[model samples]
Target: MSAPGLLRTERARLTALYGSLLLLAGGGLVALVYVLVGQGLYASVSGVVRTVSPAYRLPVPGETVDVGRSPEPARTMAPGETPTPEELKGYAFTQDLSDAVTDATRHRLLMYSLLALAVFAVLSIWLAWWMAGRVLRPVGVITETARRLSGENLHQRISLDAPPGELKELADTFDAMLGRMEHLVSAQRRFAANAAHELRTPLAVQRAAAEIGLAGEPSPQKVARIRERLIGVADSSEHLVESLLLLAVSQEGLEPGSTGPVDLAALAAAELAADPPHALTVVRTLAPLTVTGDRALLGHLVRNLLTNAVRHNRAGGRIVVETSSDGELAVSNTGPVIGPADVPRLLEPFRRRAERQHTAGEGAGLGLSIVAAIARAHGASLAAEANAEPEGGLTVRVRFPLPDGQGAVRGAPGSKIG
Candidate 1:
């Protein structure tokens, strides 16, 4: 439905709710007043009857009574004396008058109460509707802001200026959310632009090589060289595609069914052993460490870390890989000294240090980004710090919490070699 129609429906619902609550409260108050007024009037009439009843002089049987004087006391009368017919009639009339007065007063009170209730009910509904509209005015502003927001106008905010209460709080929170959304959208746009640029380079190279090879009368040697170059381009493209896919998967998060006990220590050892760094000395301090996560993703994380360390290392440098039973995995390597300021940007996709940018086909700069994503998916903490040594490098540590029913096992303390 349209926005206006939805807003009207919401307002109507709120008005109805307010009106219902007011009606219930007003009805109870009117009922209470009706009861109290009726009781008070009845009591007043009864008091009048009690006070006036004693003044009436009724004649007694076989007794001579003065017509204008006060009636004789009952105790002074003889035991056999009985009330005359006139006295009985008079007593009945007085009782009837008292009852009539009480009934008349009660009827008048009931009529007034009903009239008051009818008038107040109408007024209550109108008042409730007005109050509801006032209360919902801020909501209307919020709705308008949301309606106007899009990718092109994500920077817009409600910025409502109202009293310090729930409405103000809601507006502030909404503005904060919009700010965050704007940041993420901007970041995503940059990432897409960079990725497109990166992908196009390899394609352009391949196209140029193919076109040149097919040109008039290419020698066999030339053809062989072109084929090798094309293969290198294809390899680079494949690596970029794989890295992008892995980054996407890491961002998408792990499914519940894919989670199980994973041995991080074993995965680290396996990765190091499979691709031994020839030029760099490798140190292993792996111990038995288990965590709950997707095994494949964990292995990918380990491999990425190992690859980054090897790819970025200097000749004859050392790489240290360590795992603790307490669910800690760390990798450090010797390379060109890295600045502390560049540590954070290294985890962002498509971001790389200037030194590594010229290393052809070595990486797509998503190695640590994928590792960070995978660590987030597994509820683990990943931290990177520039080495404190005069010779620069990076130390990346990933700490995973043990799964339920698994206790942490303390082993020898790991060291940070400068």
Candidate 2:
């Protein structure tokens, strides 16, 4: 059977179980009452029979005695001829009526007990079914709502109206999960559209360069220029595709047992050294720091931060990279002043602040986003703040959890520059 059929069967079983239990208890009570009343009535009747022995006598075996009737013909006896007490004890006509009364009472009691039990059994079953339905009504509603849910109708919620209980908690949790799913889905759709747009721009450039430059057989100089343009566009497209792939992988998170302790300071120093600080004054306050994560991804994260700082900086600007033993790394650079509100958009894929200068080697704007994804994969926190310098720059900080769950040591890293 399907899930709903199984649930209905379970509900029916619960109803039957509860109803049977109640009916059995009631039947037991009725039976107990019947037995007790019969026993008490028998005892009382025996006592009365013993008390009135002289007035009433039971018939002997094999004696056909008529109750409440004299065996002899009705006749007036003389004073001397009156029956003695001893003779009356053996009187055949004086039959005991207590036995008959007790028997009749027991029969009536059994009949009433059976009748009441039958009536209450039916009543109890109905009550059980009603109670079961009341209790499982929330479950049914949740099932139906879940069944109707899809990507199209994920906006709908199981806003169950019930008192605080397990069922209500379950419903609330489900609603919370649905909300997260909807957000994730919307974000994914946006990411896809943005990526397509980013990819299309380069392709369009290559196509235009080809059509305009190579319409007919041209000079060697023109072909060389067109070649350079196509190569540049192809290179940028390749970089964007790689960035997208890396972002996707980082979101999936690192594989288990594929991580180790990496020195954050060492990684930062290496990235800065590898990339020339062209027309930039670089300052580093590197301290010994270690964190557990994927080393390659960590290296990429460091490289991205440095690249972002360099790309966004003005000519002859200063760049400061800092790392501490407490597992915090920060990169700050001098650039056009950015607003605090605009800082968050930089962490989104393909989002760039309008005030920033776009240089020839400008990135696909996924540097900070990839960094954020890698940080999340390593169970770290990332935050960006606009620097207070009049020549404006931005500072990005990342904090990773200690390997042994030690307390974090917080301290200011870089000094203000003129």
Candidate 3:
């Protein structure tokens, strides 16, 4: 059934349940009252019988009563005359009349009690229905609000102004859930739009190049030039695709099988060895820093920071990579001074600072975004700050939580001394 129909049905059921309970309770009380009234009436009649029975003098069967003095009086009839059958009949009728009155009074009392009980039953049921509606009013509101909700109207909240109770708590929890869903949906929409925009640029470039190359006469030199241009476009497309894939992986988070303890110091050293810095002085202050996370993702995090630092630096500039025993990894580089306002945006997907210079084949602007994703996946903290010097540069730091049974080592904060 539809939600509103179901809710209405539930309300009806609640009313019925309440009415049934009231009937049971009210019926018991009425029955008790009826019994008490009957008992009291009977007791009063019995007391009257006990108090007045001795005051009346009635003749017994086969007994005589003196009507006049008859010591020497002439007898009117036989001395032991019996009562006529009519007199006996009249005596029995009188006794039956008293019993009939008592029976009629008892019947009247019973009828009145039942009438009152019937009226109260109806009243109780009506009251119960009303009370049930009052008690479930909040639930009805929630149901209606939920029924009206859709993706476009996710901003609507229950906002129930109710007293403290379970219903209020339920409304609060539902509102919180709606808030989270709204955030996630908004983020998803933004990501899709950004990804489409990024992918469209390279595809458009490749298409334009192909059309230009095929539009004219076919010559060997021209064909070679077209081939080179096409290859460069293909290369850029490939790089962008790879970056997108990595970003997706980071956002989805690490798999259970890929999680383990990785030494950050060792991972940084290995990445530097594989891709050494060119025209930039590299300094490393590596200490053993162990953190529990996915090794491949952690490697990507380190690699991206290093790449960002190198690609954005000036000629003969310096890069400093530091890892401490306290699970802190920092990368600082000397480049164009950046504004403090742009620091936060640099970590968002497809966001690049306008002041920072980019070399050819630098990146697709997802380096720091991936880093931020990986850090969040592993429950680590990431902080980025622009250098204070007039030359302007960026410093990125990631602090991983210490592993189980390992106390965090405290030390002085590291500085960029390259």
Stretches of candidate 3 off by over 4 Å are 1-8, 32-117, 134-138, 161-164, 213-226, 278-283, 312-320, 324-328, 332-345, 355-359, 379-402, 408-418
Spell out the clash pairs found in candidate 1: 337-392
**Tens-digit per-residue lDDT, 75-165, candidate 3:** 2333456544644554455455546656777788778877877887888778877887887888888889889988899999999998999
Local accuracy of candidate 2 as per-residue lDDT tens digits, 109-185: 88988998999999999999899888889999899998998888889999999999999999999999999999888
> Over 4 Å off in model 1, which ranges?
1-8, 49-90, 160-180, 210-224, 253-261, 278-281, 292-294, 314-317, 336-341, 355-358, 389-391, 403-405, 408-418
lDDT against true structure, model 1: 0.81
Which scores higher on lDDT, 2 or 3? 2
RMSD of 1: 5.0
Roughly what TM-score does model 2 have, to 2 decimal places?
A: 0.78
Q: What lDDT tens digits, residue by residue, belong to model 1 across residues 1-418?
A: 7866855676677877887887888788878887787767756775686456643345455555443324654433355887767666766765677779988877887788788878878887788778878888999999999999999999888989899999999999999999999989987998898799889988988899988775898999999999998888888889899999999999999987999988888888888779888888998999998899999999999998888888888888989999876778889989888787888888888888873453474677889989999989988888788887665788788888787666763442332211
TM-score of each prediction: 0.79, 0.78, 0.69
Residue 324 accuracy (lDDT) in model 2: 75
Q: Positional deviation of 185 in candidate 2, in angstroms?
A: 0.9
lDDT of 3 at 224: 90
lDDT score at residue 151, model 1, on the 0-100 scale: 97
lDDT of each: 0.81, 0.81, 0.77
